[model samples]
Target: MRTRRRFLIAALAAGTAFALAGCETLNTVTGLLGNQLNFTQPQLQRYLNHSFPREFDKLGGLVSATLTNPRLSIPSGDNRLRLDFDIGVSALGARDVSRGHFALASRLRYNPATQGLHLDNPEILAVDVPGAGSLLSGGTRELVNTVLVEYARNEPVYRIDSDVLNRLPSGKRIGATDIEDGRVVVRLQ
Candidate 1:
């Protein structure tokens, strides 16, 4: 009886050690595979889609615009993302709403404080207000530009949760963000 009890304790100890070693090996493998996170074009598009339609009021509520139907794409080898969306503008209590299309192109930048990706150096490619030929001129264009600036500065295009980062080993954090093969790849270290 005494020998059986000693053997049982030894066996339990060995099993516990083996389980710990297996966990260590698993951790190493997870670290290797978790070095990067890939976000495809469709995933990015979905994120942007859910974020709109963003509404803005300018000129002391005289001009109001809503941005909707966001279409996002990551062009191959371009290292930039493009967003094309529809805009509806109403002015001075007018019942008629002017519809337009706006295309914006920008590079992506990572914000450490937010643990998210934001638009960087955004440039307006096109602003087409159909039937309103000169709408992209002067005040209208400036208002649109102002709205874009606010979006780029304040809103994150893609957010990385802390729990996701916690999956990495200690001392590892996102190191770089790049576009490759029409996907956004976030690399960690």
Candidate 2:
């Protein structure tokens, strides 16, 4: 009888262990099925890299500017994304181009219909032209803002995959998007 009781005790312990393990597995699976989609900084940078070297002509094509080498970063403690670019400016007929650096920060706006992320409320952080101090301070700032607005309106920084969205449960969709923990997060609801 003692031997039989020992065997029953072992079986009970084994069953409890299996039940605990099953609960853990279920928790992990539900976590994976949660309503969050994350895009890392490198992924976003890859998309932005393909949209670079945008050229703009103003003043009836007399003044021209080219924005290239887009570098993206998320500033600590801030919810905005920053983009730094190499800017080249020149007259329409001039061979000499003034080189500068352009920095801008903006919030991310996601359009569910288009599955695209756009730069929202972009503002110029800095416009640095080495050895040409204050050269791009006033009128040039306005011109850069114009180019920024145009770029923000027409170009999407990154696009969400429709296939991924389609896999979500029916009637659920992305409700909010933000820059968090150095990642672009799309929260579904």
Candidate 3:
């Protein structure tokens, strides 16, 4: 009888552990079954890495700003996507060229009203202009923000189709999002 009890306990523990795994594998599988995104890390990375550049170009959001070496990392202990990309800027009215970079770290949450993921507190984490140390007078970050705002004003970063948006309850929304153990997990109602 004691051995049977032990076996039951062991099975329960294992089930709980798998349910609480840090990756989105299980979540993605369940999500897909429920008509939601199968948000695995590789899939998310590939889609974002491909889509963002084109969106940026279409918006003409960043004036004379060209992006390269775009990379995305899921930092530990943070429920946000950390995006890093190198930029080329036409300085001095396009006469001189400069190189810089930007980082966007923000919390991901779903807004039921829109039924879309929202990037909270998005900002440019860093900017380094080569050979133009004092030109902007420490306002490089500010410029980056301005450019981002323009892009956001015109289009959302990620959005679900209207048909799907209409199905979700307006008052119910995702409570949290996290990327850990190589998975993107978003809490859904």
Q: Local distance difference test, per candidate?
A: 0.77, 0.77, 0.57
Q: Where does candidate 3 stray beyond 4 Å? A: 1-29, 32-38, 52-63, 111-116, 132-138, 151-176
Question: Roughly what TM-score does model 1 have, to 2 decimal places?
Answer: 0.73
TM-score top scorer: 2
Cand. 2 Cα-lDDT = 0.77
- Candidate 2 lDDT over 70-187, as tens digits, reads 9999877788889999988776555567888989999888776567889999989998755333333345677788888878887889886666666767777777778877767777
Per-residue CA lDDT of model 3 for 117-174, tens digit only, reads 5566676677776754443443556556765665434433355446444444555445
What TM-score does prediction 3 earn? 0.58
Report lDDT (Cα) of residue 79, candidate 2. 89
Worst 10 residues of 3 by lDDT: 54-63
Clashing pairs in 3: 24-183
